[model samples]
Target: MRAPGDLRADARRNRELIIQTARTVFAEQGPSATMDEIARHAQVGAGTLYRHFPDRDALFHAVLTDALERMIALAETTRKQEGLAWDALSRFVEGCAGLRLDLLISVAGSQATQVATTPEIGEGRARLLKILDQIVSAAHDEGTLRHDVGAGDVMGAVSLLIRGLPTLPTDLSAELKNRALRLVLAGMRTDPAPIPPPVPAMTANDLIRRLSTTGPAKPAT
Candidate 1:
């Protein structure tokens, strides 16, 4: 057997290779592609693949969660920029969306957002949600979006972004992503005038707390 340190190093290397191959395969085939193809392309043995992900869905979940976390990081970084609420959020979302096609495709049919129940997924989710909520509530508070739209509704919007995942070209440009986000954002707008000021950083807990004091924080992006 290998020493623990050696095993850890090997696992990390395998994970990086898997994530890289998954990004490529997912872009080409979406989430339903066979594991054999992934293993073949990555040039790793099936046993090694299984060692990292016990099943197809487990692999898909890992890929998906990793993607959303990247977006969350973008959101946190973008929120500090000074500008109109819509532009800041739009640029961040569009920027992340541009980079997300592969990850989104990997988990497309599975709908397995693995972020909430999985370990280490929270730091990313909380930060991502906080940024998203900040922009969303900011829009409502600033009269950019409708006031009646709830955070659940915003979550539904997030799901729509995923559902539309397969359709979006993996290599989209600044203008195209903007067009797509605009269409989606427009759907959630309402007639109520703005009254509430934008809230602080968004979080899964805070977003869920708004939904119900008792419900689970939404698990996926």
Candidate 2:
């Protein structure tokens, strides 16, 4: 495949549009989503979609990469613009929630394991984690965040909370996710109680290592 920079302006636009539309369709319809459906949603021709992605795996890879890049950009922007460390961290988390990353993962199923292990995705994950560690450390220094928690802890919590119930209505699931995030954020704040966490905090590097070893979750028979 040609590098994006090598594509003509119109080709690049079509490629981006197809990837964005596929992200939404896959999140809603899972791995069963068809190339024809993606093309329809993207308002592009079948040939256009194929020309850009060639196949579902290709499209899925592009969508995941795009999401990671967007999250990295959001974190960088939040870090630069927010005056308070807590505010920056919160804003970045909120933006990630909006990206619906859990939904995309749900859609990918076992394919997620393959795509995540790719060198590009691995590099992107590292970059994002590095930025998050900076934000978490800043919050710690400011005394706004609990000293026991690390960037990995924050990411792990958000991942759990943002995963919506597939059976629930979309609006209801989103509402519950928001409420859960609020509770988690509150819990992460320093409390008067001096009780230490049961387990040692996992740093960003630890998280990366753990994820590298993780396989796709087995489906319930």
Candidate 3:
């Protein structure tokens, strides 16, 4: 028989494969996709998939976690680039917004309370928010974005746009999204720094929990 530790490692690797495969499926097909499809895509045995992710929502949450990681990475990179605050912040949001599904999850969870708050999701979102706050702050100080738009407010607004990442209406979805981000930035600009929104009570973590629970309902094949 295989050593217990070795067996555990192999199991973890397979579990990761399931998560990776499911993420691709969710991105391509949506959150409601069946486990059967996910298994096929991941090339894992059906039993293996179930062993790793017993519930549909668990698998869905994994996909969202992956997406959040990507968003945080995007924010981290942009914060390093030297540019006009408005320009960098605009680009960052647009780039980050490309991860549409995750953003939508947060928005839905925050407003709808469809998903209860979860710890894992809350941690992932905090990193993304921190990055956004940094970018917005730089822009605000440089007077690139609206001086009135508080960095916190900008982060929240950008999160919404990303959450609603929609299929591009025209042939150029990307171009349109960037343009929209710019408009949002322009609207936020003040001579000093952007102001924040009124207290709504729900934090980004609350929204992430909602997202983790609900996921993107992968549509039927």
Candidate 4:
């Protein structure tokens, strides 16, 4: 029999391949893409796939958690640069917008049920939000963002844009997305008059918990 270390390494390699294959397959075929498909793509057996992920929800939660962790790392790196916080915020927004769009689209099209709010996913999301809060707070202190706007508002704007992206023509989509983001950013600049009170910002846990409750994506008109 192989040594324990060798077995562990082999298991780790298989898990990595499974995740990589799942990401590509999900992107191409949406969430309805089957475990069999993923296993075939990864060149692994169904038994191995089952060993790694018990169900579609488990797989999706893993994918989302991985994505969130990467975003958190990106946000932290951007935050460290001593520059206009808006610039850092804008970079993070631009980088993550496509990722968010892909994930939402996959979820919408997938056969998988709602993702479980696993603790690891929750913690990753919370860390991302914390970094975002830092960026937003810096912008507020610098008087770049309006007094009333908060980190949640910025993130919500990104989500709105992502949700609308699938509706635009392929030729016009990229350009329009940038233009729309610019318009929203301009709107967030300091204003002379006090704006009406906005809704309270959602906590990181609130955001993660609500993902499972999202309704089916309406057909684009």
Highest lDDT model number: 2
lDDT by residue for model 3 over 74-134, one digit each (tens)?
Answer: 7777777746666667667667666555523532333223322467678888888877777
Cα-based lDDT at residue 88, candidate 1: 60
Instruction: Write the residue-wise lDDT of candidate 2 on 1-221 in tens digits.
Output: 78888999999999999988887777667777789988999999999989888877788778888988988999999999999888898888778877777544666556766866789988988999999999999999999899998999988876776566555545445655776666677778786233233235556786456545653333311
Off by over 4 Å in 3: 1-17, 27-31, 100-116, 163-178, 189-221
Model 2 / residue 49 / CA error / Å? 1.0
TM-score of model 4 (CA atoms): 0.69
TM-score to native of every candidate shown = 0.58, 0.82, 0.63, 0.69
Better of 2 and 3 by lDDT: 2
- Rate residue 153 of model 1 by lDDT: 63
Q: Give the clashing pairs for model 2.
A: none
Off by over 4 Å in 1: 1-13, 101-127, 149-151, 165-178, 185-221
Error (Å) of candidate 3 at residue 1 is 19
Candidate 4 lDDT at 130 equals: 90
Predict model 4's lDDT versus the native: 0.69
User: Judged by TM-score, which candidate is best?
Assistant: 2
**Model 4 agreement with the true structure over 29-133: per-residue lDDT tens digits:** 566678998898899999998887888877787777667776887788888874988778777776676555366445663243346356776788788889999
